[model samples]
Target: MTRRPIFNRRRFLGTAALGGAALASPAYLRRAYAQSGGEVNIWTYNNFVPEDFQKQFQDETGIKVNVRLVDDQGKQFNLLAAEQPNPTVDIMTVAGHRFLQFVDSDLLAPLDTDRLTNWGNINPTFSESDWATVRGNKWGAPILSGMEVLSYNTDYVSAEEAQTWDTLFSEQYSGQTAYIIQDMMSIVMLMMGYDGNMVEYLDDPDTAARIVEEAKQFLIEKKPLVRKYYDSGAEVQQMFVNQDIVLGHSWNGPAAALITDGFPLGMAIPQEGSYGFVYTFNIANNAPNMDNAYTFIDAVLASPEIGAAMTRASGFISTYKDASQHLNDLERKATSFPDEQLANLQFFRAEANELKYGLVDPAVEAIKAA
Candidate 1:
């Protein structure tokens, strides 16, 4: 995780002082012991782990689960960075690409695959990915996967036209398209003939910068075609359903839910490719309860039962090998891609040079300014 100006020494000191006060408070001490010993604090995006699963895990293991939800992955990185020297949270749910930032900063502990009895049952694509392992040490366990694709209202845009990123710039859809602001850089990179996976070419600084600038220019040029830029999938879905927008960039999960609800929606796999990500569970380096943390992860991955439950709740596919058998036809159809489509999906992995060359944030700021 890159350290931003907002999380400086003064902010850390303030947070630490507040934490000290909380720990010293009589009311807090009265309940601290009960919440500390067998408890595992998790920092994750909202709804990734359903409340029912938390209850089930607590019942089966006798360990208390305290979840702290964040609005996005970037906040997860910021929080972890701020909680330095002594992190209060024990485990975190992070996106695959961002896992490397944690691992590189020594914020995560190497996971023991032996403790995870079901590790062998994880899909090879996830377990074998470079994102999950660094120098032969596994840092996290894969939980779920999803795609960022072009979602269009079938009433205004034909499925055929939606099959390419060019649809975003089409004259027919001018001022009628909404894009997820977070995806602007990747969308521009894909349109510029790059694979959209920055990790693949990070070692080549010249090439990386060239592509970043090209993507930035593309976004600047195409800004006039977009009606609005959204930060949430729900916002994009609402606009699509209301017929306020014909096409937009969206995640597979929410798009699937909207389609199931009878919205005139369809997800398209662009010819250039769609962005893919795997979400993982990582143990904090300063975890107060290591035993409970391992137990929690093991329970989550022990079988297809928990994986299926999570998929049903989040509308994302599980990395559990046998999870498909438990999914209904609609759930499977919404999440899984055909073999050919799967081949075209591009994963965002850890790029050691990302901080130095990444232009996504600047591009987003420029779009917002425009």
Candidate 2:
């Protein structure tokens, strides 16, 4: 079995055909359950579930594992909607904010924590978040967490200067700095003196509109400094490797990948704080193999061994508290955030949807026009 890079665009797009199929038919559902000899079908992003863990689950439970990959949450939701009457996907890894949409649509099943023996091992920071629970019902298990952090080529910029978001907008790096297209809003919000959490600003229409305008103006002002607006972390890594860009924004995983590959790369948690996100494991409301789904969640997701392996493979932090014991010093530093940093981190809350369409979309348009 060949291990593929976790963030390859080619691999993610390879499963596009599956996304177009009308999935929830009675015949299709039956086949999904019966075809793999008692397999559990999981729909998630590529490489989020490591191959070794999949094999381990099958060995212990005598149940085969079939994984279907999607490129993003939008495509995952479209595919799930197609599988209406009885969704074939027994398990899924969904973004924290998207979980609220799933709950609002009645697409997810409430988790039975009683069956998840290792549930108590999860860190309170993740387990206690409103993102994991909806209206007092636990909708999913927090699996991995990460931040959208600043990364700089240490040779080009001092580590001390990279410690603030202001470095990205500095005159010295103009025409040499890069930013992810998707992160514009969060970066702009951080620049505007608002905590990067969109939830707080979204409560009132006046505040939301004001924040939107401020973010737009910030982006427009910084447009000249941005060398490129990339679509993926892998793209940013490539630019850094080629020395095409010296400073940029990146997710922890891709930045860690660069560091592991011996690049003079360093991830920074700015004084304003890093933008955070969590990935949760949720069961389909009409999962064909409910018992096997629960078993998989308990045995694999909650295991410290699995968490350690996943962190080593992907460079994203595991939510299981005991998992830290299994990590080596380097892996621990790469994956885990310090308590002070964690306290300042602003997670991508449920209001990101509104911010995306209502704030970010127009902001991007304004930048293009400028």
Give lDDT for model 2: 0.71
Q: Report each candidate's C-alpha RMSD, comma-separated, in the order given.
A: 11.2, 8.5
Instruction: Assess the local accuracy of residue 357 in candidate 1 as a C-alpha lDDT between 0 and 100.
Output: 27
Candidate 1, residue 5: CA error in Å? 48
Candidate 2: 10-residue stretch with minimal lDDT: 22-31
Candidate lDDT scores, in order, read: 0.72, 0.71
- Can you give the lDDT of residue 290 in candidate 1? 86
Candidate 2 segments exceeding 4 Å error: 1-36, 82-88, 336-343, 351-357, 361-370
Off by over 4 Å in 1: 1-37, 199-203, 352-357
Q: By TM-score, how accurate is candidate 2?
A: 0.79
lDDT of 1 by residue, 39-118 (tens): 88998754567556676567556688999876567667778888886899888987877776777777888888888766
RMSD of 2: 8.5
In model 1, how large is the Cα lDDT of residue 259? 57
